[model samples]
Target: MVRGNIRGSAARGGIAACCGLAFLLFGYDQGVLGAVIGLDSFRKEFDDPNRNLEGIIAAIYDIGCFVGAIVAFLTADYFGRKGSITLGTWIMVVGTILQTASFEKIQMIISRIITGIGNGMNTAMLVIQSALIAFGHPLSTFMGLASRQAEPSSFGWRWPIAFQGVFIAAILMFLPFLPESPRWLVHKGRIEEATDVFARLAGKNSTINDPDVVRERDDIVASVEEEKKLGEATWSEVFTEGKNRNISRVLLGAGPYMMNQWSGINCLAYFLPITFERNIHLSVELSLILAGVLGIQYFALSWL
Candidate 1:
């Protein structure tokens, strides 16, 4: 039994790691614009001199995020968490390609919107995935480790976006091995499949091959059945009845967290090269190397 528990924990940890990859993509997308916009080519391409256009381009991405969040909330219940995440991955791929190919500021703005949508959807999916994993297994430790290692280097923004594409592909490949949330399955009235998933996750070869697995499955079924008999509202109905009020409150309260991005620290760090070259009278290459060192310091602080 102890061995089985260990195996089960490991499997869940693997799934959480997969979900964390998605989150890392989200973070990379969030930070890539800052890093790349500081490059001479990017500024010259956009014909931006005083850095005014940078804020507009960045804000467009945030606008896209607003749209994506609304869409994710509406579709998560209908499509299921895994399905939504898969869709988000496709969006990320297309957005990355568009951004990479963009030659004009307007085109890049559109691409940022596309990428922002993907990021927002993936963020919602990450929360759902975390909750699902936490339901059946202890995932705090895995999540902590994953969060610490999410960011990569600051060479160029393209590297991070390209890395996102690679990780998204890896996630899609690994999704087939993961069990869908049994709670979601049960809610959808897929009792037998839910039981099988639970058994598999618990390391049983088959649902019928293990007595403890059978008992656990029965418990879940019975609990879901009881809830069904109580005529609990559908997601939409619950939302209408203020069931989501607390969630809304929490989200609203956390809005200030996004302000951290605009706190000037990241902007200064990103443009450290330009700042040094223009303000302190340094060479571009030397300024870039200094900027990199400062970026490393910020990245290290993220882990702390």
Candidate 2:
């Protein structure tokens, strides 16, 4: 039976709050790198590797992320969205800790990979990020500045990286209380649970057969039925299924994102301060300030 409170505002609020926070941490991790890569103390410690090396250092995260995305799809059938997200959070916490504690290049790279894996898993379940996740950019920038100012030491980069776990902890705290995705439950043939979750999320305090709840639940169940009619879902079917040309649709959908990732946009986000300071010959202080501004812009526009 659905928990009496499951359909209350509290449950929906909990879902949004936890998911938003996790996404926020993911964004902040992405943004903080730009600042971390350029810090004077960090550069001095690591001898300011060349652009290619720096690129490799940053890009390896994507490698792990790619692997994680595949793993997410493969495992999601069994684990469900909530399970995947929970496991991802644990991996991210471990990754964030290792990243914070790193003292060497390879260690940082490995940690980045671990962190990316967690992100990839989380994203697979829920890719919607806007206002909340956007905070990651500005906060990362702010943390960078704070770290710099606190300094006679290297705490600037480390602290921002480390604090990522704070958000992760919040997510984990709420996970147990949250309902699994209704769609996932439906797909797994847990119709009653799906109906309950749908009603709860919609803030409707209604019975299993209540008109509104039944309509929504039936709509979702119909989709699952359609999939069942199409033969067991498999990689082979993805390329051959549906009048919409499923493979083409998938390509159409993912093409832009694929292009964007390959574009140098993220490279700039991760290493903007370094790029400005090194290539443009801007003063380090000035470059960092500009990077912070860029973060602010990203944050504001993310809501759009």
Q: Compare the candidates by TM-score and give the number of the best one.
A: 2
* Strongest candidate by lDDT: 2
- After superposition on all C-alphas, the RMSD of every candidate to the true structure, in Å, is 8.3, 2.5
Compared with the true structure, what per-residue lDDT tens digits does model 2 show for residues 158-182? 8878878888988888888899888
Clashes of 2: 3
At residue 38, give the lDDT of candidate 1.
50
Name every residue pair that clashes in candidate 1.
none
In candidate 1, what are the lDDT values of residues 1-304, reduced to their tens digit?
0122323666677677778777656545554554455555556656763567777776677688778888888898777777777787788778888887777878888998998898778777665332321111112112212232332322234444455577678877766667666776777888776776666667635454488777877788888889879884565653352645855765577767667656775455234455776789985556555655555555455553
Q: What is the C-alpha lDDT of each candidate?
A: 0.62, 0.80
